[model samples]
Target: MGLRFLVVEGNTRGARQAHKQAYGLTLSESYAEVLQEIEGGAVCDIAFPADEGANLPDAAGLESYDGIVLTGSHLNIYDRTPDIVRQIDLMRAVYASRTPSFGSCWGLQVAAVAADGDVRQNPLGREVGFARKLTPTEAGRAHPLLEGRPAAYDAPAIHLDMVTALPGDCTVLAGNAVSPVQAAEIRQDGGVFWGVQYHPEFSLGELAAILERRTDILVREGFCRTPEDALAYTADLAALHRDPTRFDLAWRHGIDAEVLEPQRRTREIRNFVEHRVKTEKSARGRA
Candidate 1:
């Protein structure tokens, strides 16, 4: 049998609907598409843990899947709302199940908070559009997840909250000046989670759509001097998405092959499947 994967969307129904309207795909849908693309013939199931009364897999049910992926969310984990609580509970169950898991952006926050770490609104402000110059630590340098990454690279990102305190069993992987916890590996209750602060599944077009929707915040937060400037910037991103060969636009944005190349951007996810998921499947006699 092919690999079976679960995609846990961290967004509520309303947020996901709005995201679908703006980006043409729900976050989990996009994540699932990427997973299928990476691992051919893989089966992916999506669950919305943040939705009220949403059905979630228990530990035994979770063990049926080879791996799990958590998607980014617009909600803050610190609020501890009922919806947020549900996601945390689900993640804890995942840890207990000892499943291999991976996450991005808000997903990373969920993993951190669920593991007894802390996440807070970044005092330095939001790191939107792209996280720049993420350098791997000593551990990350030798980590299989970052095996193909360069000494420093950029990736698409948009987040207001960051992990401030790490759990005892987590190792900091890569970090930039804006966020100290860029990428990490968390081992809790025999379960392992690899996560990054940036969105590997996001394309320039998706990010452009998001930026267009958040133009007001972009201007208010000084990411752009005016709404027109924000729209113009997003236009460049959209244009680049249409034609990645536009080196002029790439150079203007200082975006190199890391963000421009799909394989490089999603190296961690592929690594997780190859190193963690496949290895576990083989160990369980499922491979």
Candidate 2:
């Protein structure tokens, strides 16, 4: 049988539309494309509503998919807004199903909260653009979730909140000075949760688009000198992402070639699809 997966969108219509216009794919579409490259299977898209008290997905209803991939969110998890609280409830359902799961940024934060962990606005502020040099913890070196990852690697990131405390049975798999819980693994009675504080699913083009949208914020946050410079910064980064041979241009723009390689940045998701998700499918088939 073919593999099947679900992408739980964390962005609303406004944010998802902007993402589509910039990256030529919606958040769910982008994730589906990435997974398709690895698993070449079906992807199911589901999302939370923008209304005041949207409830979470029913975990029992999620039995169809082999695994779930949680997307990043514009909503901060710490606020406990009705929608966010609902997302946490859905996360609990995900864990209870024992469904192998993977998430990023807000994904990590929500899963942390449901598992009795904590999340907070990083006093250091948003770690946008890049999660630079995330070194794997001792556990990360051996976890299948982190298989094939380098000792230290870079991933595109854009977040204001982070996991400050781990869940009841979770372990820190990867981290850096910017965020102490960059990646984690939670083992519960029924399911397993793996997450990253950065966007391994994001392409550099996506990062560039995000920066383009946030030029004013970046300037105000002291991340860029001027709006024009920020635009140019994204342009150059997007170009180099398309062609690593533009070493000189990349250098002028302050991009490290080693960190700019797409394969290295997307290693985590690749492992999830290839090792965990596929393995689960095979196991169930045999059973």
Candidate 3:
């Protein structure tokens, strides 16, 4: 069987446009072409509403897919909407079924809330610039997905809220002074659940564009002082642009590098597999 990824899109219109513009995948196309080049067979389904607030597709509907990935959106999970509830329900069902699941910014927080945790407006407004330093826990160092990642790596941060506390048995994989729980992994559950505060799917230039476009809003909301400051803060952004190996080396020694390299690792697949095997076995027993 081939690996499949069930993508949970928050907003069909915005998500579709993002995929097309950033990854060059149009709404009309199966995510095959773009995903194959980026993640190969590791990616599968890309779920979305044919229109807004449509009923969520069923979980068994996605049985052919092996894993779940929740897309980021501007909406808060706590908002009262059928779509939010449906997405939350689907995520919880994925957990109950032990499906391998991963989430980005908003997706991460939503997953945490669905697992009996909490989400709130961060006391610290928006983390609009590059968070240059993130200290990993011992488990983080051992985590295959995070291992070989710099002791501290920079990520282009552009979120108003974050996962303040994680679900039970969830290990904080990466953190810093500003955000105590930047990355987390729940290994004790039947299906491993992983979430990152940063956008792993985004490249540096893309991240910059996001911050650039939202500068005024970020400032008005007190997420940052100014758009110019956020974008011109090269030290952090430059560090974020570093390749995984070099970034890790620089982070360990606190030395800077002239150029950064992109880091690509398939750790997500490993974590996804771990969850899938556990969930499949559990589902079989129940059957």
| lDDT tens per residue, model 1, 16-35 | 99889998899999899899
TM-score of each: 0.98, 0.92, 0.73
lDDT tens digits, residue span 145-164, model 2: 78878778777898888887
lDDT of each: 0.93, 0.81, 0.61
- Model 1 residue 278 lDDT score: 94
- Cα miss at 244, model 3 (Å)? 14
How many steric clashes does model 2 contain? 1
lDDT, model 1, position 172: 98
Root mean square deviation (Cα) for candidate 1: 1.0
Ranking by lDDT: 1, 2, 3
Q: Model 3 segments beyond 4 Å from truth? A: 12-35, 49-57, 187-189, 221-260, 264-287
Clashes of each: 0, 1, 4
What is the Å distance of residue 74 in model 3 from its true position?
0.9
Model 2 TM-score, all chains together? 0.92
Candidate 1 lDDT score relative to the true structure: 0.93
The collision pairs in model 2 are: 98-191
Q: What is the lDDT of residue 117 in candidate 1?
A: 97
